[model samples]
Each structure stands twice: as structure tokens, then as C-alpha cells.
Target: MCATLVGGMDRLKREYINAAKANGVELKVFTGKENCISEKMGQTELVIVFTNKVSHAARKEVMHYAKSRNIPVRLVHNCGVSSLRQNLATN
Candidate 1:
């Protein structure tokens, strides 16, 4: 599955990417909210947002775009590798 990960620290982003790789999931991570554009949304099957790390406007925009395109989105408060793993594992 291809997923777009929005908002996370550099270290956490790397960890999430590594974890996703290990799980056979392709992940495209965007550290800044600005990178969560509509163009990128089209390439992903899922959208996971780190709620605490991103701006409200950016989050809203992402949610709106994802919903419009009928893509699934998961929002997590923590931006850790474990959290990402658990979320992906369940869905």
C-alpha cells in the first residue's frame, strides 16, 4: 500500500519510513505542512497525519482533499514509530 505521512520530526520521519518499509508498505513522508499538497494526495492510498505536529489549516486542507478523493486518512496525536506501526497494522 502507498501512504502519505504528514508532519513529523526528522528522526521520527526516518523511523516511520524504515518501519513502513519493513512492513512492505510504501510511504512518502512530508515533514512540513506545505508539502501536503493536492498533487501528492493523488499518489497515496492513505493519508496519516501527526495531529500535534501540523498546523490546523494544513490538517484541514489535507483532510478535505483526501475526503474529496475518497482516500482514507488516519490521524494520530503521537508521531512515533510505534504509533505509526500500530495504526498501519490495524488498518
Candidate 2:
């Protein structure tokens, strides 16, 4: 599976990436409000937003892209690695 993660600290990002890799998931992370390309969206299976850290515009864009492609999205307030892992495990 491929996942797009928006926002999180460097340490948390590393941990989250490691966790995803361990679970056989490829993760693409964005820490800023930059727009994602359609080619990238094509490879993404899910979108995870760390609500407290990401900008509203970035979140909206991601949600819009995912919705257009019918990909699943998970919104979590915390940007911790454990929270991300837990959310990802459900889907």
C-alpha cells in the first residue's frame, strides 16, 4: 500500500516511516503546504493528515485530490508515530 502523510516532526516522521515500512507500506511525506502532483496522487492509496501541524489549505487540497480519486483518508489530531500506526492499521 502507498500512503501520503502530511505534517509531523522529524523524529516522529522517521518513526512513522519505519513503522510503515515494517508493515510493508510505502509512505510519502510532506511537511509543508506544497501541492501534490497528479502523478503522485495516482500512486497514493491513502492520505493521513496530522491536523494540528498541517495547514488548512494543504489538508483541503489533499482531501480534494484523494476524494477525486476515491482514495481513503484519515484525519488525526496528533502527529505522533504511534497514532499514525494505529490509524493506518485500521485500513
lDDT of 2 at 73: 87
Best candidate (score: TM-score) = 1
After TM-score superposition, the amount by which residue 49's alpha carbon in candidate 1 deviates from its true location, in angstroms, is 0.7
lDDT of 1: 0.84
Top lDDT hit: 1
Q: Give the TM-score of candidate 1.
A: 0.89
Model 1, range 1-91, lDDT digits (tens) per residue?
9998887887777788999998889998876557546666557888999898887877888889899889999999998888889888987
lDDT per residue (tens digit) for residues 1-91 in model 2: 8988887776576788898998788888887456664345558888888999888787888888888889888999989888888878888
Per-candidate alpha-carbon RMSD to the true structure: 1.4, 1.8
